[model samples]
Structure formats: C-alpha cells, structure tokens
Target: MIGGSGHVGARAARALRRLHPDLPIAIAGRDARRAAAVAAEVGGPTTATTADVGRGDLGLERGASFSAVVTLVKDEASNAVKRAQADGVPHIAFSDFVSEIGPLVAHHVARPTRAPILLLGHTLGGAATLAALHLAQDLRSVDAIAIGCVVDADDRGGPASQADFERNEQIGQAALVLQDGRWTWARGDAATRRFADAEGVEQVGHALPLMDVVSLAAATDALSIRVDMAARDASTRGAGHATDLVVEVSGRLDDGTAARLRYDIVDADSYARLSAYGAAIATERLLGLEGGPPVGPGLYHPESLIDPARAVARLEELGARVRRTRS
Candidate 1:
C-alpha cells in the first residue's frame, strides 16, 4: 500500500488483514514513524517502509517485489502507477478524479502491462456505483441514475483527502455529469440537487465529477447520470447518522411501465471504514483470493472487476446495512 499511514490507508491495511490473515503486508508512506505504528497495529508479517511516491522506483531498494500496489493517496504525477506497470503488478488507485485521469489512461494506452489497473475513484471507492448497477439489474431499461452520499460534518478525512479538497477548490474545476446522453461540466445550480437522505431528511448535494458518472454511463444506457455529496452534522441526528450512500435509478420495467428503484447503504461506522472495505475487496479481487480468476492486463472500473451482489454481501458482513427505500 502506498499511503498506508493515512486514515483510509491504515483502515485498508486492517481490513485486508482481517480478510486475509497470512498475507504479507507492507505499509509504505512518507511518514516512517506513522507507517511503523500502523504496521504494528495490523501485526502478522507486516512491515513499514518509507516510500517516496514521486520517485520512479517508489524509493524502494532494487529487486523489491510485491503482489500488488494499492494507493489511497492522490498520485498527481502518476509515479506510483508507472512503477506498478514496470513491475507488472496489479494496481488499485482510490483518490484520482475523472478530470485528472487522462494522463494515466494515456500512459497505459502507450504501454499496457500484463497486470490490471483498477480506477476506483467513485463515491466511497466505487461502492455507490456497484450498488446502483446491481439494483438496476432488475429493470428493463435504465434511463437515469442519481447517487447521493452524505458525509458527517465532523468526519474530516486524512491529510491527503483534505489536501485534495483544497486543491480542487483552488483549481475551480467544474463538476462532470452526463445529461441527455451528452457529457457536461456542471456548475452552480446545475451541479446541485435536492433529495432525501438515508434518514429521510431533505438535503442538497453538489456534484464533484467522481468516477461513478462515467462508469455508470458505460455500463448502462442511462441518458442521465450524476453523483452528488452533502456534508451534515451527525451528532445532532442521534444514532444511525454515520455516512450513507443513496442510489436512485429510474427507467422502464420489463412490461414497459415506468419504474424507479432506490436503495440506501448505511454504514454505522465512519465513511473511511466503508471506503477501506471497498479497497480491501478490490485488492482481493486483483489477487484472485476469492477463488476467481485474477484480473488481466488493461485499465478497468470497479464495476467491471467486481460482482455487485457479492460486494453488497461483503459490505454487509463488514457492518454496512443495505435497505431498499423504494421499488
């Protein structure tokens, strides 16, 4: 793991340890002390290493090997990606945005590797998209999809996540969405939507150009697709106020009648934990630990590599509650 010291990365390490007890783990980050602490907490053949993501070799000694490279940080320079490619190991990146993924895609196209590269930058590490796709399977046609994620106000993420938020604000990049089968850069009111949250409270969500919009569009013929997020105070809401992912899909049924479906994935714990579960699950899929074939070379979305039903089951096992709000 590249950012194994951060909150999400550390949680991913723990989740991986729980899922695969004997897997050798390397907690790598710029902060050697913090990495060591995390590794010690994870226990069982885990090592902490100082890694410089900016370096070509990831600042590791020559001949170092790993089964896969999972990064929870934003790799703006794509250094980690290139290194993974050179080593021919599966790579899973969690913090890249759709606007900044062009160079990485281009690099892979120029020289594809035998190991798979999974882009899991969706809301909560592709959790929302995977659930939405699974729910849409019961419909005959999918015309529109809207995903909303609620983050607790007090749940400020790690340094890397906060930095990414600050960087996006500084850059002022418009949110990406698909409308009427056309890609659009939404802004202001156009980028905002009002919907009921998991607690049935009215909330306004703002678009952020997450990877879910693109992935959903490719998977189904959804004429309109967008993902928005809202942050609120969880303390005031009593219990069941942790982060939640709301997915709504609308289209026609097999009988040609109008239909809509909505589901809520409520996590009683922090969003970081839910996201970590997603990363750990993806790591297992890449390594073929679930008795399935390992992912082959080429870039892919989480929807392509993961089975939504199985992912939902795994999330529930990890303390996420999935409830159908509409049908």
Candidate 2:
C-alpha cells in the first residue's frame, strides 16, 4: 500500500494483518519514521517503507512481483495513480476524490493503459453498493437505487480529507439524482432527506454528489442512483460533531418490483477512522479473493468488483449493520 502510513492507511494495514497474517504488507508514507511506527503497530510480517507519492518514482524496482498495489496516499493523488499505471501495476485508489473535482484525475489514470484501477470512494461506495446488488439478486431490472448515509460530524479526518471537502465547498454543489434518468446540479442545501437509524430518524443530508454514484451508474444498468447523507441521532439543525452514518437505498428490481436497502455505520473515532475502515476493507478484498474478472482501468466503486454479501459480512465483522425492508 502506497499510503500505508496515514490514519486510514494505517488502520487498513492493521486490518489486513488480522485478516491475512502471512501476507507481506508494506506501509508507505512520506515520513519514514511514521511508516515504521504504523508497521510496528500492525506487527506480523508487515514492513514499513518510505515512498513519496508526490514524486514520480516510488523507488519500486521495475517488474517487481506483486499481486496488487493500493494507493492510499492523499497528497499526490493522481500522480501516484499515473505512476502506478506506468509500472503496469493493478492499483486500488484511496477514496478521496468527489464528483465536484471533475474527471481529470480519474481520466488520467484510465487514459494511460489497460491496467486495472479501482478508485475507492466513500464507505458506501463498494460495500453498500454491493449490498444493494445482493438485495436485487432476485429481481431482473431496476429503475433506480438510492443510498443514504448519516456520518458523525466529529469523526476525525486527515488533512487530505479536510482539503478535499474544502475544495468541494469552494467548487459549489454537485449533481443530485432526479426522477427518471436525469441529474441536476443544485446548491448544497437544495436537496435534503429524512434519515432514521438505530439512533433515530432525523432530517439531514445535502446535495453532495459522491463519486460512488458515478461509479455505480457506470457499473450497473440501474437507470438512476442517488445517495443522501445525514447524521443518525441528531436533527440537522443541532447535529453536533459525532461520527455516525445511516444510509437507505430504494429502487426497483429487474422485474419492476420495488425494493429498498438500508445500512448504518456508527464509528467511535473521527471521520479519518471511518474512512480508514473503508479503505482497509477495500485492501482486504483485493488481497483476499482470486479468479475474479480484472476490474478495468477507471474509477470504480467497491460494489463494482466485490460481492455485496462478502462486503457486508466484512463490515458487520467490523461493526456496521446492513438492513433491508420487505415490500
């Protein structure tokens, strides 16, 4: 993993160690000492390596033998992705890019070569989407799918994450899902929804367009996919800084049957920790399975490649709940 040293990266490294103790995991970061510290914490056969994501050459030998490479570094963003493509490495990108950033980074990574690239975006990106797919297994066609999230405001986030959010705010609002097969670019407050979870139901969410929607739209035949986010336990007006998430997805199955899926994640740590778990889950998926079709080069959601049932099982093991309602 290229960004194995940071908060989410480190957590992912630790999770990998627990899941695959014999795997040779390496944590990379700009700071050598910090990377070493994280490797130490993860223990097992894991080792720490120093690599600058900002620099083109990550110092890896050409033709290095490795099954997959994960880019968790936040600073270099697209640069690391390009370099990985140059090295002809199958890569898993960290979940940092939002739809407002445009397609520059994703496009660049996909433009280079046929190397498989998976861009991890949002905790709901892969696992949650997969859960939706699993729920839709009994159906034939689906008109739309809406996934909702309630994240704790107080969750710790890294500098890169903070920067990404700031950039989105500066860039204005993003696309919101509309009825039929339409999307509208609306202001942040223009879209809002009510969310209820283990904590309770509250009106929350903004017009934040997530890359997961983009990836899912590309991956599945679902005509329209929407994601709304809110805080679980508090009202939108007084939601203090706490790390929690409540997501609900509604759509029609292939047979024109209506269906809905709900998922909630309550993390005790800050935003960074929750994000870390998301990244870690992706890494585990990449390393754990085999014989799957190589996910092509481009930005991808977790659901695109991983089995929804498997993803949900892992999340539950990590303490996230998946809920479904029968109609």
Candidate 3:
C-alpha cells in the first residue's frame, strides 16, 4: 500500500496484519525510514519502499506481483487515482472526514486513474455506507436516507484533515446532501439530534456537508440522502477533533416501505486511535479477509463498498460498539 508510513496508513497496515495474518503487506512512502519503521511494527513480511505517489512511478517493477493497492497519502484525490492507475492496482483512498472538502478534492482527482478507485471520506466511508446498505437490505425501494454521526471531543485527525478544514473555512459553504436527486448546497445551522450511546444522552450532532452521504445517494438507488455530524460538546469541535459518531439512516424501501437503521462508534482512546482504527478497517476489508467483495477499483463509502454485518463486526472487534437504536 502506498502511504503506509503515515498515521492512517501505518495503523491500517497493522490492522490488516491482525485481521489477516497470512496476507503479505508492504508500505511505501517518501520517507523510507518511516516506512521501514511502520513495516517493522506490523511484523510479517512487510516491505518498505521509497516512493512518492504524487511524483508517480512509485518504483515498482512493471510485472510486480500484488493482489491490490491502497493509497492513504494526503492530497488531491485525483493524484491518488492517477498513481493507482499507473500501478494498475485496485485503489482505496482515505476519507478526509469532513464532507465539504472531500468531494471537491475528489472531483478534481477521480479522473486520470483507469484503475478502480474508491474515494473514502471519514469512517462513514466504510461503516456508514455499509450500514445504509444493510438497512436497505430488507427494503425494496428507498426514497431518502440520512446518515448521522455524534463524535467524541477528544478525537484528533491527521494533516489531510487539517488541510480540509482550512479549505472549508475559506470556501465558506458547507457541502449539502443530494436531496431528491439534486445537489443541494446550503450554509446555515446544522440539524441537531439527541444521541444516547455508551457515552450518555448527548444533544450531539450537526448537519455538516458530508460527501459520503451525498455520493451514496447519487450512486445508490436512494433518491435523497443526508449526512450529519454531532459532537458531545464544544471541546470536541474543530477539524481533526475527535468524538464518538452515531450513524442513522431512514428512508422508504423500493416498495414504499419505511426503514430506518442506526449505528454508533465511541472512541475512548485518543483521536488518533479513532482515525487509525477507521483506516485499518478499510485496509482489512480491501485485503479480502475481514469482509465484502474482492478488493477492486472504484470510489466508495463503507456502506456501499463492504458488507454491513462484517464491517460492524470488525469495528466492534477494534473496541467500537456497533449498536442499533429503536426506530
């Protein structure tokens, strides 16, 4: 995997190892030493390679043997896509957390790469997406879907997250959901929701411009989809900040039946731990050990990309409790 040296990538490498010990894992980054260190920590036959994904060529042999490739580097999504295409490997891109910035970057970066590219945005990329899919399983048709998250205050994020936040403030427009099959953009008060989880009954949540919900709606059969983020308190507010996330999806089934699904993640650990676990879960799924279809090309959210049951089970094993709330 490219970018295996960074926080997300390194943690993902370790998670993949634990989830599938027999799988061969390798990490590549611009900094050889850091990559080597991460590989060592992961143990097994992890190899460290010196390559810059942004610069292309990653230094891999033309006929190199590998099942798939995951890119966790921070930057334009298009760049990641291009590099993955060059390597002719299935690509999994890290979620940028915030929805406003991810799609903007992805719009510019998705082109160029012919390889199947999956654009991941936040843990919602996997968990939220899969949950939506799972919730829709019993239904025939769904009119609209909403994904909600209530994060803890202590979660910290990586540089990419920091950059995305900075850009969001500059843009001054929150990414809106795709409602009724249209892109709706708005900048105003986020929707508020009360969440009762392991943490407590917290009035925690806001309607943030999340790309995953919008993208999921656009890509899936759902006509309308919304994603919201709510935190426990002010201390947890800000970019790269950490908090527990509560995800909920409500919509009408294809047969005009009402369906709703709720899931939650409480991170007692530091913010770094949350980010690491999210990345690791995605990596493990891509490796074909933890869950879902064989790793392949295309942009995706956790819900659309992997099996919900398997994804939730993996998250629980990582210390995150996946619970369903009463509809």
lDDT of each: 0.86, 0.61, 0.62
- The window of 10 residues in a row where model 3 has the poorest summed lDDT is 234-243
RMSD per model, one decimal: 1.3, 4.1, 4.9
Instruction: List model 2 lDDT by residue over 1-327, tens digit each.
Output: 877887678777776676678878888877889989999889998877777766666665454555567876554446666665665656776645555334435554457454566767654435556656666565565556666555655433676666766776676646456446666665645566555543565546664566666656665567766667654433342333345454445566566767664555555554455566566667655554432644555545577567766766776676654445554
The alpha-carbon deviation from the true structure for residue 292 of candidate 3, after best TM-score superposition, in angstroms, is: 6.4
Q: After superposition, how far is residue 49 of candidate 1 from its true place, in Å?
A: 1.0
Ranking by TM-score: 1, 2, 3
TM-score of 3: 0.76
**Whose TM-score is higher: candidate 1's or candidate 3's?**
1
- Over the stretch 1-327, how does candidate 1's per-residue lDDT look in tens digits? 999888888888998898889999999998899999999999988999988887767888788888888988987778888877888889987988888788778867977865588998888887889899988998899999999988888787887888987777777858899999999999999999998888888888999878999999999999999999888877655487688889999998899998889989887777888889889889988899963788888899998889988888888887788897556
The best-first sequence of candidates by lDDT reads 1, 3, 2
Residue 105 local lDDT, model 1: 85
Tell me the lDDT of candidate 2.
0.61
Instruction: List ranges where model 3 is wrong by over 4 Å.
Output: 58-66, 77-79, 95-114, 139-144, 179-182, 190-200, 219-224, 233-243, 251-260, 270-305
Q: Give model 1's TM-score versus the native structure.
A: 0.96
Error of 1 at 327 (Å): 3.8
The residue ranges of model 2 lying beyond 4 angstroms of the native Cα positions read 59-67, 75-77, 96-114, 139-143, 176-179, 219-224, 231-245, 252-259, 265-268, 271-274, 287-300
TM agreement with the true structure for every prediction: 0.96, 0.80, 0.76
